[model samples]
Target: MEENIDIEQLRIPEALTGPEAADFLRVVEISRLVRMHTWGNDELAYTAGELLAQCHDPYEWNVMLIARVNGVIEGCAGIAMPLDDNTELAHVTLDVLPQAEGRGMGRKLLEAAEQFVRGENRKSVLVETNHAASALAAAANEAEQIHPTSGTGYLPLSSREARFAFSAGYELERVERFSSCAIPLDEALIAQNMEATHAPHRSKYRVHQWLDACPDRWAGDIARLEQCLDRGQSPGHGDWDIAKLREAEEFSALTGRRTIVTAAECVADDALIGFTSISILNHRQDVAFQDETFVELEHKGKGVGLRIKEANMTKVMREFPEVRTIYTWNAPGNSQLLEVNAQLGFISAGITAQWRKDFNAY
Candidate 1:
């Protein structure tokens, strides 16, 4: 028999200074491990300070809830709502230890988070679960081992999260492919590619590199590209109030991050037509997350996308010696960017499904 657990919100100052700090971090560690094991994603081991920062953010509202049974932490949930646009939308994320499943601990944590959102008058909720290809493959192997069916062959991918979300009344909205590559990328191969693809257009455009901040001259140009990305990935049926983006935000000082950006400039007009960037947190120097990569409509078909990526990869290898892996996401329909990633040596890691639910429906 499993014991019922109580869910409590982990507040900032109290969680940091009080006697429960260590326990809070322990819960986070277990949740992180469960995510990695179940989703086949990167180990995003976050620190207490980072967690506190989210709680104190001015532009976003966040809450972290921990579930405990007899004073032992078993699971946790994260709730967030953007302060600006999409005011009615709240995002929820929950993770439970593998051995703790079937205990209803996850459901309890989620109910608390959803209740918190209702208190804030948020009418809609969004959540995402990453499905790794490795996990699916492993499940297929086990299904075959147990017994083989007819032409159906293997069992469809199933997860505790999907079932839980469906049971709680969430609908699948979209699915994005996850890809990654071990860094210190094969320089010889990329160099050869650069020569064959980007060399012919050398006189037309030039590549520029920066760390943490974009130059003053390119601010406006970069802002436009950022907007392009916002519109490019938006779903037709998605609901939203406003889109606030700026170049200053990207260059703003961050405590424990080093941003590396590579952009392509058209020589004729010296305009920043495209860019790609990766950020490495101080505590996780070995892992870099691909933030965004964009090329303006006018610059399309000239290989600007590949050029910036290749240039940035070269700089990261030389500048960030600790970087070992880079992870990225792409909608399967975006074949162009996917091809560029594949050419740069990224392999499919898994699938990421976006889920949403309207409070009115319930």
Candidate 2:
């Protein structure tokens, strides 16, 4: 007979030193190790503070469940549902320690996640799987390659993540490329992009910079731009308003992160045409993440994207000279943005596929 596997919901504590800190730390370690084992690196690992802030975020409802066997934690599952919008969707992350695999731990954790979302009355569930570039290329020609509906990227059917998601009744919706660029970027590249951004069409737009908080005059416009970006990806989901924007800013501060933003405004109308943001983790000064880049439909193709990205990059490199690398993700079909990234010296790091299970369809 097997020892009983107990599943319990975690109560996110107010601080890391609280009574539940030990258990929370265990979950964090297990989650970090699982990702490191899978990706062969800790490039995307999260600090405990970062994870805790995510759980405490006011804009989302976050629940974490841990699986224990004989008082030892073996795995965990986290489900996050956006409260402001997309309330019908639950994003789930399941992680099981390598040594604990093949013992039905993953299955149990996933089942718990499904049950929780069902109780919340969510209609859709989303999960992501990561694949290294080398592994993907090795299996590119295999007959079992799974292509997303977008028809632009492929994942190996032989991969464990693909097999697991498929068995769990999830469909491949889209794929994104994770790329990284070393800091102290080449002077020539920066100079060239800057020169190109000075074209007549782009000259009409001026760039604005901020360190942490958005200026009062631009807050409303920033919220609108965020909404536009959200809707551009998921038609009904970009409901960003001023309140949510402030909430996100507060969340960033709570995570001990420095938010740097650069926005482009049309001189003729004084309206924000595009914007880009980069975040630097206070705990890890050598690394940064490119959060988001958005341009109005009419302002694209005129260097708005590149201008804002470069402006933010220049500011970050100057203010934080210790930064070494910046990471970003983009859909394979986003040719324009990909081109801009390539010009900025970003190289492919890995690929991640988005999978979804629609309960309402059943």
Candidate 3:
């Protein structure tokens, strides 16, 4: 039986509760399809369960809109606020089912998302899309730039998606390369050596690994983590405080699929020094994904960074023996961390470019 998509019945909702699981599943399935279509690869496709887990995170304020025709979900859009920083940029991710395309549903969803951001008094909104969506490109180009609010589009690489951003009035701002280095976990002596080198400065600090929940003792460490993250390369955004960092921790605990391995100071210090965490994403039973690793500026130059990483990698190998390959990403300019990983036997896999444009002028 063919269900009719009633554009008029579609509505945007603030939150998804337990009762809406079925509808949310449909939305996620549609979203996965859209992502796969846009990226031309299934490797990036996230399942409905994964989306649900992600949405459960408390740190991100995720909004979902459902386009329904007679109560059947035909399309959906979502937005997330990272770090819960009021001054930081908010991101939007949207998708319409194949049957609902070309019917102006996507435009409606975008408008709803924009209104939500405006209501929050946010400074800007960002979205990532591939080159395949011509209509999305056109919509971005035609989007109005309200005073104090602008839209920018970026292309990571030259593709059908890059052209879309160009047509939408987005310009390339910077190209960030995402590279991964992997090392075999069989070298315990190397790990111990790395730990020993970083031990003098790391003496007062301790490393904690969390598998199922967020640790309470690391609250201060979380705050310091945010500070370090600020120093790292990201799309320009405002700073984060303790409250926001807590929210981020809660969110990761709820949403992240990897083991959260954190190293932090055992005693509080006024200098805001000592801490790092590496999220290991277990994609396949045997593959580990090193999504991010960070250390504070004051703690730099010491072996603290490398020691924490070595400890985390050692833990992952011990706990998840099935994991054969570990993947990681680094900004193009981070030579220090890059050199450390190189010493540990991580080889460059590939590069992903970061592109951006200021939408304020659009």
Candidate 4:
């Protein structure tokens, strides 16, 4: 018998506990299951609380479409569009239960999401696939390879997600190395890294550390650094300012997460030269994500990146001792940052390929 699958857009309630909470929670559970099945672990799964915050976040618009088989939830697709910037791009994530494959549930949800984004007049859709590092080389010789437009990295064409995106008219955009480092790192290792990267010229710069909220004095400079990072990701995009920074920090706190930030400042003029940050789930401290590390172009080769990253790691140990692992993503072409991460004990765990479908081109 062909199963009957019904898809509907989920209404995110103001409070988590309501008539709609059950479906929302099921979607969160499905996300956990999908990550576990895909990566052999659920480290990247978001908690229900976190999902609620994301839905309520003011700077971004998010919607979830759920697929139910005979009144039971089985799959979901999420579309996230940035209201602050990248307004023309929608990020889509689709997940279906292991037993529900090949029954058209994923396809239905994806189609629905595509229709919704198109209705909103989005210019492009972005999707990502994660592959285990150990298995990549095994099929490198046997399977076809797909390289991103950057031409710097490749993913096996045999991967299911890659094939799905390719068939759907998406093009490979970039490949990023996913890495993790065991934390509560040896104090000696941290000390050694700090000393090795230290320079006399570095004495002109001082490191500052803070929690979730930015100090009013450095707000403007921090916004500038954030804009720098944003421009690096998407050129010709604008509107990253102090207001957006506050909105982001407020959303992070509302998501039951805490952020630890380390920033470098020039002593001569008191300008921020660079900054780095790590975000941890307050309820689940075993793992965290290394958010952003950016340094001004003029200060790139002065060991600013390493100094901020190392100082941030030391703070992570002092503040969140339960953080056993810290994970980060880097472009394959960014050898300098990768080398800094390597020195900090990070190792490649997997690779994630970013795909994009430009509606006008397609």
For lDDT, the strongest prediction is 2
The TM-score that candidate 1 achieves is: 0.86
Error of 2 at 326 (Å): 1.2
Error of 3 at 18 (Å): 12
Q: Write candidate 2's Cα lDDT for 28-114 as tens digits.
A: 898889878877766677778878888987778999999999889989998999887788999998889988887888888888898
Candidate 4 RMSD to the real structure: 2.2
CA deviation > 4 Å runs, candidate 4: 234-237
Candidate 3 lDDT over 1-362, as tens digits, reads: 66554433222223545564567667767877776665454444556556655665554666676677567677776877664444555676767776667666666766676677767666566655533334334444443421112222233333544454345444444333333444355476585666567646666666666663446666556655655566665433346666665555565555545554646554446332444344544333555566556666666787767776777777777777666666566654678888777766676644333333344554
lDDT of 4 at 293: 89
TM-score of each: 0.86, 0.92, 0.61, 0.92
- Best TM-score among the predictions, by candidate number: 4
The C-alpha stretches of model 2 lying farther than 4 A from their native spots are: 1-4, 234-237
> Distance (Å) between predicted and true CA of 137, model 3?
24
Clash count in backbone of candidate 3: 9
In model 2, the worst 10-residue window by lDDT is 230-239
- What's model 3's lDDT at 40? 51
Tens-digit per-residue lDDT, 100-132, candidate 4: 888888778888888899999999888877788
- lDDT (tens digit, per residue) of candidate 1 on 242-277: 222232344235446688899988999878888999
